[model samples]
Target: MRISELKKKGLESLKGKWGKAVSLMLLLFLINVILPYIVEVIGSGGFVQWFDQEGTPLWSDIFGTVLSIVLIPLTIATTWFYLDLVRKGNPEITEVFAIYKDGKTSLKLIGGSILQAIFIFLWSLLLIIPGIIKSIAYSQLFFLLRDHPQYTILEAITESRKRMNGLKWKYFLMNLSFIGWGFLCLFTVGIGLLWLIPYIGTTLAAFYDELIVLQEDEQPIEG
Candidate 1:
């Protein structure tokens, strides 16, 4: 699909489901605010000083590794929640987590994330620009697998590469739209961006869903 058409569909999808979208955005905000502390408390004994005196043991490293593992599923849960709001019209946060109750979907999301991270890391060795380019290139990957659960990691990565071709500028510009807000958050010590993060995330989710999820031969349904 053309960039213009994709953006139009994203806007239409947002307008058509404004209420659920708002609720989803709110739930997302709440989670983003609370989850970091929750994870820290659960993982870190609730205080930075908890680690200050420790020279760092294997157990602590193991604990941190396990925590990182746990975050993959949790992150997928949030991404799934947002995508459900966009595609299935379901606004329920609980239900989004519940979809991965079977655990398969969450695994896919985690695996995709790991692979994307690997790609980003390898690309970064060339220069920071390549890393950023790869990050944006594969940004839609989670959304793609969330919608099409059958996609393998290789398939999703290949498809992402294909969809990103010739549209790097478009994706960069779309992400650039949020740079001001992101910078504001950075300047304010990141508290300001918490709420806006989920909204912009879901909106961008809607953007990719509208623009690139469909098969190359398929046309988007009229809004």
Candidate 2:
């Protein structure tokens, strides 16, 4: 599907659902941003003290790394929630934590996220462009894992790479299409992000749906 169609589908799916979408975004911010900032402040005695202490920066980095790793499942679950919303139009708010309900799935998501990050980082060492390209190539890994629970981390990664082939530029452009909305969000002092994020997430889910259809059509016939 074209980017315009995907975006239209996303907007249609979000109709009558903006409140819930914005609420979910706020909850995510509480968990991913506010909670971390609070923890860092407490750890350093206060926000101002974070910069005053000599070794606090190192500890802050360590804490940030560990927190990000722990949050991998939540991150993927958020994606799944958006996918569900795009496809079904009424995903439960609890769906944002679905990965945690399955221990094995949570582990797979965490491991896959770590490995994906490492691969991207290694590619980044070569140059910024390759890293960006590879990141886009692996962009579908989490969605693939959500759809194919039986897939191993490496299998999902490999398949995402294959599926993204010849479509990286299109995907990149699809994301770039959001730049205008992103800039508009700046005028709201980031408050507009609650709406913009869900807009982007649902559009991405539509993109994935389109890719799946393309994949099915590309399959060779079995005579």
lDDT string for model 1 (131-208, tens) is: 998888787777767666777877777777777777788877776676777877787776565455555656676666
Question: Which one wins on TM-score?
Answer: 2
lDDT of 2: 0.84
Give TM per candidate.
0.71, 0.89
For model 2 the local lDDT of residue 75 reads: 79
Itemize residue pairs with steric clashes in candidate 2.
Answer: none
The candidate 1 region of ten consecutive residues with least summed lDDT is 214-223
Model 2: per-residue lDDT, tens digit, 1-223? 7889999988888888888889988998898788877888898888788767666467777888888888888878887878878887588788777668888888888889889999999999999999999999999989988777777788888888878988899899999999999999999999999999999998998888877536844432221
Q: In model 1, how large is the Cα lDDT of residue 170?
A: 81
Model 1 misplaced regions, further than 4 Å: 1-58, 186-189, 214-223
TM-score of 1: 0.71
